[model samples]
Target: MRWISKPLPNNDVVNSLSKSLGIDRVLAQLLALRGINTFDEAKSFFRPNLAELHNPFLMKGMEQAVQRIFTAIENNENIMVYGDYDVDGTTAVALMSTYLLTLYPNVVTYIPDRYAEGYGISYQGIDFADDNEITLIIALDCGIKAIDKVAYAKEKNIDFIICDHHRPGDTVPDAVAVLDPKQVDCHYPYDELSGCGVGFKLIQAIAETLEHPFETLIPYLDLLAVSIAADIVPMDGENRILAYHGLKLINSNPRPGIKAILEQVQKTELTITDVVFIIAPRINAAGRMKQGIHAVELLTEQNISLAKKFASEIDQYNADRKELDKKITDEALQQIRENNEEQNSTSVVFCETWHKGVIGIVASRLIENYYRPTLVFTKSGDKLAASARSVKGFDVYNALEACAEHIEQFGGHKYAAGLTLLPENYHAFKNAFEKVVKETLTEEQKTPEISIDAEVDLSYLTPKFYRILSQFAPFGPANMKPVFKATALRDNGYGKRIGKVEHEDDLPEHLRLNIIYGADDKTYNAIGFGMGHQLDEIQQAETFEAAFTLEENNWNGFTSLQLMLKDVKC
Candidate 1:
């Protein structure tokens, strides 16, 4: 792995902001790195205000979508709130359906079966809507590429108001309104919304239409924040505001569904990372293991007892998902070794009986060992389906587009995507994808690089400095957790390899250290996960440079700062 220090901010801007805010220069420099040049921008960054969110009506199809929904409400028409099977889709369905049911009684949610319907707007889902006498369908997190399915719904007199964030095709669906910000014609100021974020915008517009105060919609932000985190969208702009307040709700008074899920964990305050790890997988496990609607049911349940029951059931599904993915990942790694394809630019493996639900997770797991673009395929009916994951700085979607001739259908964004193809075309498509990635990936892009925000000395990591840095919460893609590099660091002789000793020959999984920077009488506690192999290097070197993020560690009711080391260089 390569350690790349980010470009330093302009000295003028950093000094000016530091003086104006009366903050540490390091904190000001961190804000400057995130493009906060002035006091106002810094305030907005630190304290995200919901009022600053863009007007929903600014979206290209917002007016039409709101009007269509209002028409459905006025006529008491049955409205089907439809979405994909993942966390973003289910949370979007739960948010939209529950909100619509507040205004009208004839609303229902539809999450297509993962195995039968595959993904996105499906014919089976449309048929279900038609059978239920639903006249209007509000599709969320999907439908940008559903030209045919939308037309099929139209034939049944069902109007579509799509709220999606995926990239649109050459031609969008003929829905009443397509509210994807990715459309070139749509000029929404911030376009990096999660699917649930788009769903929130729709309801924001609806709430405004009814002249309701903005606080009426605050309760729904928890769902939006979950979607934003689970879908891995940028944690800046609209997402930051939504996640900030949503996290507050999660920690203070979450909905029964979320509360029940939280009951299983021991956290007092949940961060965005906690939401991703604790809540998302449970909600997603319902879809991956059973039916997507189970997640929606859990999210929408009002009864605490029933919600706990649902949470328990979903927890089992998550457990099953974990076991299956680990087994399949082991099988996939073995396949790579058996085929002697370890040196390939890409890792593409397939099995006829591999569970379709776990392929995506397996693909990601493969990347941890191989460190390359990966695709894990499984037989989906007559065709083969795959989940694709890419390394840092690589666009899997564009790479799939280059191999479109072999793909029957594909969708998703830069880092992750899903695709299907005929079984016969798998090898050919795999070769083509390998070629595309090999040709496009620069040498630096192939290796995972840790981007360090700034270089700092041990003295700069004071309690006050950390307090200011903690304000940069809810970190994700665009606004990541800050990583700082400290040079001339020596381990205080107590450093050692740590973690479980599984077997006689098994390698230790982590590194523990009391990092000493200077003769300041303070030895900083540090832990480097998966860096056990570096124990010898650290012990031999008199001093080295370390890249790490500062975090608070709590043990036995005592809390102190800890360095989460990323890498070390001598």
Candidate 2:
């Protein structure tokens, strides 16, 4: 893997801030690398007070969207909350619908089926709303590019207010208000909100118009936090403030759905990483294994018993999802080997009858081996649906747009996207997509790169240092946990034999490891996961270097720091 070091900022400025903040020079340097250099900026970075959140009216078209919603509520018009089928979509629906239900009773929610209706706003949803005498639809997480779909709904006397975060087309949709920050005309200072965040801003605006304090929306931030984490949005600016407060609620008093799910886990305080690994997969399982509506039910359920029931069902769905994901991933890998597709400029694999629900996970898995722009497709009803995942520096959405002639519909961010096409056009689209990637991509873009925050001496590693780092909680895309690289590492003479431990008889020899790292003239014990295979190599080598992150591990009523080795070189 390529190791890319971010350029450090001015050392004098960082040192001054470090002295003022009472933090390490290295930590201050990293903060300055992220453009936080002043005392005020450092305060905002570490504290993340809700007062730092941008005004809801700062977002383009937010006033119009809120005004339209208030008008619908005053008129007693039937309103539908529409969203996508992923965690972001479902969470947005739950947050907006529940908040609206508090103010008006005519609100309902609609999530299109991933298998049948594909992604984004659906004609079936609009038709259903029309039949039910719904006059207004507030779309969350999607509808930025539904130009014709918006026009069609308008023709049916249905007004739409889009609160989305996706990139808009050249011509904006003719909806009542388009609230995408990507719009050229939009002046929202922060542009990296998740779909649910956009929905939250809408509610914030509505609350402001009614002369209500923003704290009135604090309870709803739990859903926003889940969506922000699940959708992998950048945690910075307003997003950082929202996620910081939201996680406080999650730890102090989570909603019934989150509480029920956390009962089976062992974390005392939930961070964004915990939300991504523990909560996101469960919420996503609903869309992958059953329907997106189940996720909304779990998120919005008020009763403990009902929420537990939904959580249990979602746990089962997640199990089923895991098994299917493994099977399809193995099959996709076999196809790559059999056809020698791994050597191609791009990777596109199709299975006629493969489970449509797990292709996205399979596509992500293929990246570990093939490391290319990959697409995994399966037959969905009369069409072919696929999930596209791209390597760094490659915009999968733009590539898909290049091949839009053969695509029926597609939308997503730079790294990940989803698309559908007529079954007859699959071959043509695949070829065209590969051609685009081959023509535009560079050799460096194809290989995986691990970004290292900085190199530091092991002497700098201490519990106090960790305590300072811990303040950078709720880490996600933008404010990722710092990774450090160390060189001239020597393993101690002590090494454990590879064998089954007391409780794990089924584990293979390659799954065990017991090693030590020499730092500051002392040896520290370290346990490595899935690193036993490297035991012989490390033993044979005289010296080595490694990249890792410091993690606090608890065992037998004791807590201490350990190096979580990511990679090693001899």
Candidate 3:
């Protein structure tokens, strides 16, 4: 792993901030590196305020969307809340549909099938709306690229209000409103909201128009928090505020569906990472293994009993997903070896019978082996569908755009995307993609780089410092858990490989170490997951540098500080 330490702020600024905030110089330097230099900036970073949120009307098309919803409610017209099949989409659908149902009786929700209708606003979904006499459709997490589908809906007298955050094409869908901050024309203060965040803004606008306080919508932020974290959007700006409050709700007064999912977990407080692993997969499993409507049902269900039943079914789906995800990932790796494509700049593999829902995850797993742009293709009807994932400093969406001539359709962000192509064009597209990336990718881009925020001796660590770091809640992209580099680490003779899962075949997949820094008498416990391979190298050196993040571990009813090592080097 390439350890890249971020340049620290100058001593003058760090000293000033430390004096102003009455914090350790190290803590103040961390804030300064994130651009929180002034007293108010630090204050806002620690205590996010809803009033700091951008005005809902500041978005280009938000007013139009609000007016359209008002018209639907006034005339008692049928309104269908449509969303994609992923967690971001389903959560938006749940949030919007539930809020609408509270105000009007003609509201319903819809989630397209990944196998049948594929991604985005599907013609089948529009047909269902037409057959049911629904004249208004609010599409969440999709429809920005549905120019054709939106036009088809328009011919049938169904208007569309799109709440999306994806990059727009040359021309956007001719909807009544397109609330995507990524659009070149949009001037919303922060343009990095998730699909669910956009959906929340629409509801916020509606509430304001109805003379309701902003607190009226606070209950829905738990859904917003999960969507933001799972979708991997930035945690800076308004997103941080939403996540901050949403986490509070998650720990204090979560919805029935969320509470049902948390019933068996024993964590006193769950972080954003916990939500991504424990909650998101279960919600996403409903859409991946079956239909996302089940997710919406779980989130919107009023009765605790019914919510638990839905949660139980979704849990089974997650179990099934994990099995398929693992099996398919192994198969994709084997395909790469058989084809002898290990040295290629891209990893493109396919299977005719692979489960379509797990292709995206398989693409991610492939990257651990290849460390480059990857695409995992699976048969979708007559055509082949693929999920694209890219490394940092690489734009997979732009790379896909370069090969768009061979693609039937594609849409997503810079890091991840989805696409489909003809079966005959598979080999050609794969070759073309590899060529494009080989000519364009820089040498430094291929190696996995671990960015370190600061280099500090272990002696500087204190319980007081950890307490201040814990306030950096709701960490995600742009604002992440600060990574530190510690050198001169010597094991306290208890360091060894450990395994707790049977699937690991009793072979250690993790390293548990009790180590002292330099001549310090204190020792710290550290665990490095998937880093058992480093034991041989570490034993040779016996003293090396480690890049890690500070964490609190609770075991056997006792809590203590632990370093979550990201990488170790000799």
Candidate 4:
């Protein structure tokens, strides 16, 4: 693995901020790297305020969307809240549909099936709305590129208000209003909102028109936080403020569904990482394994008993999802080796029997071993559907766009995407994608790299320093948790390969260590998952360099600082 140190911030700015804030220079430098150079900026970063959120009306389509909703309510029209069958989409549906139910009684939610109806807006979904006499459809987390689908809905006299974050096509759909900030005509100050964030903006606008106090909307932020965390949106600007307050709500008083899931885990205090791993997966499992409407049901349910029952069923779905994810991942890896494609610039593997629900997870797993742009395809009806994941610095969306001739439809962000093609075109598309990646990929982009924020001595790590560092909560893209590098580190002889093997034939996958730095005589506990193979290398080396993030470990009612090891080089 390549270890890259981030460029040091300007010394003058760093020193000035350190003196102004009365903070350690390392903390100031970290803040400066995150664009928090001024004391006021630092205050906002550490204590995000909801008052700092942008005005919802500033969005280009806000007025139209608000007017459309007002018209629906005034006319007593039956409205359908439509969303993609994913965590972000389902949470947005829950937030919007629940809020609307308070103002009007003719609102319902729809989550299309992953098997019968594909991603984004679908004709089948529109037909369902038509049959049900739903006149208005508020689509969240999708519809940016649903020109044909939107046209189809318009013919049925169903108005659409799209709240999405994905990039738009050459021509947008003829909807009542499209609320994506990615539009070139849109001048909304922040553009990196998650799909649920866009949905929140629409509600914020309606509340403003009704002169409702902003505090009344605070209860809905819990859903926003889940969406922001699960969708992997950047944690800065408006998103940071929303997530900060939302996390507070989640820990202090979560909704019944969230509370039910939390009761199953043993964490007293949860972080953004905990939400991503614990709550988001259970919520997503409903969509992935069975039906997304189940997730929405749980999120909106008021009865604690029913919520718990729903949570239990979703947990079973998650267990099934995990098994399928692992099985498909192993098969994909074997296929890579057997097909002699291990050396290729991209991984493109397919199996007709692979589960459609877990192909995206398998695509990510394939990257762990092959460490390149990867795609996993499974049969979806008569066509073929695939999930694509790319390494850092590579835009898989653009790469797929280059091979668009072979694609029937595709849309996604820089790092992840989805595509569909005719079964006969799979081989041509795979070869074209491999060629596009080979010609575009740079030498450094081929290998995964660890970015270290700074080099610090172990002696400098005090409780006060850790306290300041912990304020960098809710970390994500552009504002990640700081990774520190320490050199001349030696592990005590007690270091061992940890974690139990499922079977006698399997090997342990984790490493545990008591690490010492440069004869300091102070040992710090460290654990590295999937680093068992490096135990012998670290034991043989006199000293090694390690890249890690500081975290608090709790065990048997005792809490202590520990290093979450990312990589170690001897």
Candidate 5:
């Protein structure tokens, strides 16, 4: 792992921000480095107001979508809310379908099955709408790339309104409204909204048309926040405001479904990270391990008792998913070794028996060991389906496009993608993908690198400083928890590996540290997870550099500031 320090802001500007904001110089410098140089910018960054959100009508297709929905309501025609199967899709489906039902009772919800029906706007889903006499489909988080499927729905006299955030192909679907901001001509204020965010914007526009105030939609943001966190969209611009308010709702007055999901868990307040770990996975489990209908059922259920029942089922699904994921991941790792492919620039492993739902996750796990682009494949029906994941600064989507000749179907963003192909094409596609990434990927891109925000002394790790830093809540892309570097750190000679202590050998898998550095007499304790390989080097060195984030560790009911090591250089 490489530690890369970002360029620091100029001293004069940092000092100016420090004086104006009445904050510590280091805090001001951090803000300046993140482009919050002005006091007003800082104010907006800290206090994200709903009033600052972009007008829903400003999106290119929002007006058309609202008009179509109003027409459907006026005609009393059935409207089906369609979405993908994952968290963003399920949550967006719940948000849009439930919100529509409040104004009109003819609305229904549809989710394409991950197994029976692959992804996006499925023909089976359209057939369901036609059988039910549904005239319009409001497709969320998908349909941007379903040009042919949209045409098929059009032939059935069903109009489509696509609310998606994926990158558009050369031609978009023939829908009444395409709300993807990634479209070349469409200009929404922020292009980085999650699918749920786009769905919220559609409802916000509908609310305006119905003469309802904006605050009427506040209850829906919890879904939006969970989608934003799980989908891993950039948390800046309008997204920040939505997540900020959504978190407030989650903590204070979450809906019965959300409240029921959290009934067994104990947490005073939940952050975005917590939502990703605790909430998103369970909601996603419904689709991954079973049919996605359970997820929409859970999110849309109104009664607490019924919601708890749905949550219980979803929880069990998550447990099943975890087990399947672990089993598949271990098998994939073993496959890499059996094939003698560990030295390759990419990890391409396949097993006919591996579960399709967990292949995406296994791809991510492979990156931890191989530290490069990875693809995990499994048998899907008669063909082969694979999930592709990339290291930082690499575009797996582009690489897939380069190997398009052997691909049956592929769609996704820069870092992650999904594709399928014939069993015969698997080896050729794998070779092509590896060749493309190897020739195009930079040396630094292949190596895992941590971006360090600043270099500070151990003395600066004070309660007051940490208090200010903690205000950097709800961290995500563009705004992340700051990491600082401290040089010339000599161990107090009592550091030892901690985890799996029963081994009692050189490789204990974790290390506990006691260090004093920079003329500071205070010895701070640090834990380096998975850093047991560096124990011999650290023991030989008199002084070394440690890159870390400041975290408060609670041990035996006592809380103390500790160094969360990112990396160490001797």
Candidate 6:
């Protein structure tokens, strides 16, 4: 792992901000490095306000999209809300469909099956809309690259309003309006909205047209928060504001579906990370294990009993998904090993019978071991569909675009993408993709990076400092939790492994230790998960250092701060 230190800001500016904000010089320096300079910016960073959100109308094509939707509602035309099968896609479907149902009765929702119809706007979905006499389709989380599908829908007298955040193709789809900030002509101030964020903006515009207050839409933010966390979008600017309030709703009074899922989890309070790990997976499992409609049903279900049943079903789906994912991941790893391709320029593994629902996740898992551009493929009907994930700084979508000749269709962001090609073209595409990565990528781009936010002494670690850091809540892709580096230390003798008095065959030993490290030599205790193997190493060492985050852990009616170690070096 590579520890890359970002270039720091000038000392004079850091000192001034530190003095003005009444924060430590190191904290101020880190803030400045992240482009937070003025007190107003600092205040906004600390307290994300709903008032800070940009006007929904300011987004390019938002006005046209809003007018088209209002026209459909006024004419009482049958409308279908179409989305992908992932958490973002399902959440967008739930949010838009539920909001529309509250105001109109003609709205319906549809999510394509990941296994059968694959991703994005499907022709089968279009046929269902046509057969039902649906005149309007609001495509969310997808449809940015559905130019042909949009044209096909147009032939059936159906109009489309695409609310997507994926990177756009050369020509925008022939739709009523395309609301993707990644479009070159789009001028939305923030370009990192999750799929559901775009859906929320669409609903916000509709609410504005109906003369309803924006507060009427606050309840839907929980869906957006889940999508934002799942899609790994940046949590800054308006996105942060959405997540901040959305988390409050989750903690205080979540909707029936969310509450049902949270009841089974062990955590007392959930951060954005917790939502990503716990809630997003269950929601995504609906899509991955079955159709994404189960997810929408779970999110929109009003009855507690029905919601609990849906949650329980989703939990099972998630468990099944884990098993299938593990099997496919292990097989892919074995394939790479047998082919002696672990040291290849890129990692491309294809299994004709692999479960189509979980290839994207398998692709992501492959990156952890290979640390290179990866593509996982499965048979989808006569063609082969694949999901691509890339190392940092290398744009997988662009590389896929470079090999467009072999691809039947493709669309996604810089880091992640999805594509389909003829089964016969898989080997050729794989070779071309590896060549592209080998030629274009630098060696440094392949190594994983651990970014240290700042360096601090143990003495600077305090409850007050932790509280200040907590103000930067709802951390995600762009706004990450602060990681500090502390070095040079001797144990203060407070270190000891705390566990049960006896050993049982089923129960493994757990490590809980207190140790002091730094120039000041202040005392602190640390908890390491799955680190019992390190007990012997730590016991034999006289000095050690670690990169960690200070967090408050509460157990058995007592709350105290502890160090959550990321990496330990002795």
lDDT of 4 at 192: 90
Report the error of model 4 at residue 206, Å. 1.6
Regions of candidate 1 where Cα sits further than 4 Å from its true position: none
- What's the lDDT for candidate 3? 0.92
Q: Per-model C-alpha lDDT, please?
A: 0.93, 0.86, 0.92, 0.93, 0.90, 0.87
Residue 41's C-alpha lDDT in candidate 2?
A: 87
* Cα lDDT for residue 475, candidate 5: 80
> How many backbone clashes are present in model 6?
0
What is the RMSD, in Å, between candidate 4 and the native fold over all Cα?
A: 1.4
Candidate 5 lDDT by residue in tens digits, 287-365: 8999888999998888999999998999999999999988888888999999998989899998999888889988998
Q: Is candidate 4 or candidate 5 better by lDDT?
A: 4
Cα deviation of 262 in candidate 2 (Å)? Answer: 0.9
- 3 versus 5: better lDDT goes to: 3
- The TM-score values for the models, in the order shown, are 0.97, 0.93, 0.97, 0.97, 0.95, 0.92
Candidate 2 wrongly placed segments (more than 4 Å): 398-413, 421-440, 494-521, 527-529
Q: How far is candidate 3 from the true structure (C-alpha RMSD, Å)?
A: 1.7
In model 4, which runs have C-alpha deviations exceeding 4 angstroms? Answer: none
lDDT of 3 at 151: 97
Pairs in steric clash, model 4: none
Tell me model 5's lDDT, rounded to 2 decimals.
0.90
Q: Cα lDDT for residue 384, model 4?
A: 94
Where is the poorest 10-residue window by lDDT in model 1?
A: 262-271
Tens-digit lDDT string for candidate 3 (1-570): 688888878889899999999998889989998888899999999999999998899999999999999999889899999999999999999999999988999998999998888888999999999999999999999988899999999999999999999888889989999999999989998999999999999999999999999989999999999999999998999999999999999999999999999985656579999999999999999988999899999999989999999999999999999999999999998998999988889999999999999889889888987899999999988899999999989999999999999999987778899999999999889999999999989989989999999988887777888989989877999899999999888777778888776774567789998878766458899999999878777877868899999998989999888999999888
